[model samples]
Target: MEILLNLKNRICSLGIPLHAAFEDIGTDKTVELWSEIFLNCGQIMKEQRLDAGSAWKKVISENRGLLPLEQADWDSINDFGELLGKSDRLNQESVLDMARESIALLEKKAEEAMKTKGKLYRNLGALCGAAVVIVLI
Candidate 1:
């Protein structure tokens, strides 16, 4: 549950850099902007002791139920990363759309998580704890 909430928070915060990077692309070479985005993101991930690509893979892989806030959301993020990680030429405008789409997705998921998911997790956790106590007794 904590991990889920943290993931949601992390995703939401990640959007700030993405948005800024998208805007930066308008004034700079698309390729250079993308390199900066990946570098900045990679550095941030490093601070958390996570590799650029492995962070997403590790978090999603390690806890399935914990962060299944939305499979589509995860897929979109993964796709975005893959797109950026590639050598293919990506249009600045199209990249902006992708970043915007991802931002919106994260925001929606964050709102939904706060509204209900957190409570559900708390309740379920409590139930599990009670079950463990009862079993011991």
Candidate 2:
């Protein structure tokens, strides 16, 4: 149970946009998928006798080629390493809080990106309108 919680916390802290994607898809579907993955992972850990650290290490080693988490997310990967180093000292609430903060930061970044894109579109439209007026003159 500790290993499973650790694994879940680590993954959540990565802030992979899964939760945001889940929100877009609908809460029920999100809950269902979460439950499925949780159960599957729990079973794997039990059957394989894989501790959380070993399981995560195996996943990175085996699926580095296929995992976005393994590539280009160095900061998060580093953060995970730090978390692992201190895992023995941290309480569950602290882990959850870290995950929540990561998710919030990602969501804020996504929103800001969307706002920037919207502003760019508006600027482009204004530029096009100016070009049309200049052509008419």
Candidate 3:
């Protein structure tokens, strides 16, 4: 149970966005795969007297930055893929590789966002400074 709980926590922390992304895909096989993984993890957690759902909530709260699509959410998908590849229940290298690729794409997006934010801040500061100088003059 401890093992399953740990596994689930690790997976969630790594930010696979499993629930939503899996739902979006909407394939039986994908759902089955996720269900099996979650079930096995839950069974392990149950043995240890730990509630898997609660554990999931706690993990999310603690590691919110690791979530995908967030400003600080970087490399989470890759990390999740690596975790899945390492897990005994579902060790698929190809899946891990795909996830790594997804992470790279996400990282690129993050970089672009940062650049845009920097430019906007700089422009705002310049405009504010110019307005202040004109008022002082």
Candidate 4:
């Protein structure tokens, strides 16, 4: 999300090209897999002169399983890819912002679910241990 936001700011404010922005962001070490994906997409965009949408879709499809993104997150990314290079810069920035918001919402929901389910599972484990102890006694 931060990466996408940064890309949006660079593209919108700095007027850097999409591929150039990706290549620059790809240098980050903490996100090696995403960095590789960004590099591949950047190369495709530069070498093949493909649109941002096409390059992004190609790279994402090839590396879908390795992305560590949920289906909703992938859907947001796909929507962003579909919008990229197909519209004006303002529109692209708006699309990125929307994707960021949607992904944030999904993240919040997932965290809440984890908290609830984690507590339930912990309680169940404790109950099962108590049952086993009672049986032994």
Q: Give the whole-model CA lDDT for all candidates, comma-separated.
A: 0.49, 0.47, 0.48, 0.83
lDDT digits (tens) for residues 77-137 of candidate 1:
5544433322222343355456666667788878987879889999999999999999999
Measured on C-alpha atoms, candidate 2 has an lDDT of 0.47
lDDT of 3 by residue, 17-70 (tens): 434322233232444444444444444344554443443344344455534456
With a 3 Å backbone cut-off (N, CA, C), the pairs that clash in candidate 1 are: none
| Ranking, lDDT, top scorer first | 4, 1, 3, 2
Q: Residue by residue across 64-118, what tens digits does model 4's lDDT show?
A: 9986677877876765566665677888788878878977897898899889999
Order of all candidates by TM-score, from best down to worst? 4, 2, 3, 1
Q: What is the lDDT of residue 16 in candidate 4?
A: 86
Worst 10 residues of 3 by lDDT: 20-29
Model 3: lDDT equals 0.48
**Model 2, 12-130: lDDT tens per residue?**
45432322322222333335534443344334445676543444344445434543342334344334323333343345346646755665676576688779999999999999999
Clashing pairs in 3: 1-44, 1-45
Give the Å shift of residue 57 in candidate 1: 8.0
Q: In lDDT terms, how accurate is model 1?
A: 0.49
Q: List the residue pairs that clash in candidate 2.
A: none
Cα RMSDs of all predictions?
12.0, 9.0, 12.8, 2.1
